[model samples]
Target: MECLLGLLKVKVVRGVNLAICDPLTHSSDPYVVLRLGQQKVKSSIKYHTINPEWNEELTLSITNMMHPVKIELFDHDTFTKDDSMGDAEFCILDFVEIAKRDLSDVPDGTVMKTIHPEKANCFATESHITWKDGKISQDIVLKLRNTETGELVLHLHWVNIPGVAR
Candidate 1:
């Protein structure tokens, strides 16, 4: 069974310094797969590039708030199975909780919450949830765990549905 709570808009902004999966070319044809509970989505494959800019906005219906959004990076291959570059995950409970507050009068770019890199998360650095451009958003840079090198930048937005808990 799967859970469907609400909608969450995940902006897969870009990747930074991704690993070299294709040894022959010394680069990777990369793409990201996002998984939140049972709902899964993937970005388009960027060919022959380590640093891929997806800039794609993916809307995922929140299934379980307790479950973290899992990110898996892979190098697209034609000859064989896609090579797994690395993986990362982020919990959205904190982001959703703060975004639900009264932020109408909040100043733009105001940092509402600060999440640091720790064992509980795959954050590469300190993440700031801000009220930017008349909306609540969080810019998170996740360091790919159990890999040589890679970082994923994502922007998260919580869309509160009518009758849903705000």
Candidate 2:
């Protein structure tokens, strides 16, 4: 099901759970779309059950925008049959702002690092990064299953860098 989130001129921060709790019966896996002016960015995660201590942290980042922004969340139903959004509660745990930097800004000695354990890859998926016209784009996606609840958590991150200091 498609859910429209109207922030109503509210400030958006990373790690904010944009889940719509009222309309959903079961906690649906969430996919988010962020719009900065005409540029749209998207991320998503499949629903996962929380234990006594909720350890779900979906982190996102947006930088260097001087325009209005829009964020929307869609229920990810690709992995399950029961689409009722029940037993689901979501929240934003933390928000941290990062200085906007561009691919051109990365120095010659700069190094990019990612963690992809062999076991993790055997179980989960991997991502790819692209660079073009001095801009960098990455698509990060993960579909994971919680051993305890047998529920799936889908995570996706996408970012585009348009302007890097030359």
Number of the top TM-score candidate: 1
Clashes of each: 0, 8
lDDT of 1 by residue, 1-166 (tens): 5545568899999999999988899899999999986779999999989999999999888766777899999999999999998999999887777766778888888998899999878999999988888777888999998789999999988777777655
Task: State each model's CA lDDT, in order.
Answer: 0.87, 0.32
Off by over 4 Å in 2: 1-25, 49-65, 78-166
Minimum summed lDDT over a 10-residue window in model 2 is located at 89-98
**For residue 126, what is the lDDT in candidate 1?**
97
Residue pairs with colliding backbones in model 2 are 25-85, 25-86, 26-84, 26-85, 26-86, 45-154, 46-153, 46-154
Q: What is the lDDT of residue 128 in candidate 1?
A: 90
In terms of lDDT, which candidate is strongest? 1
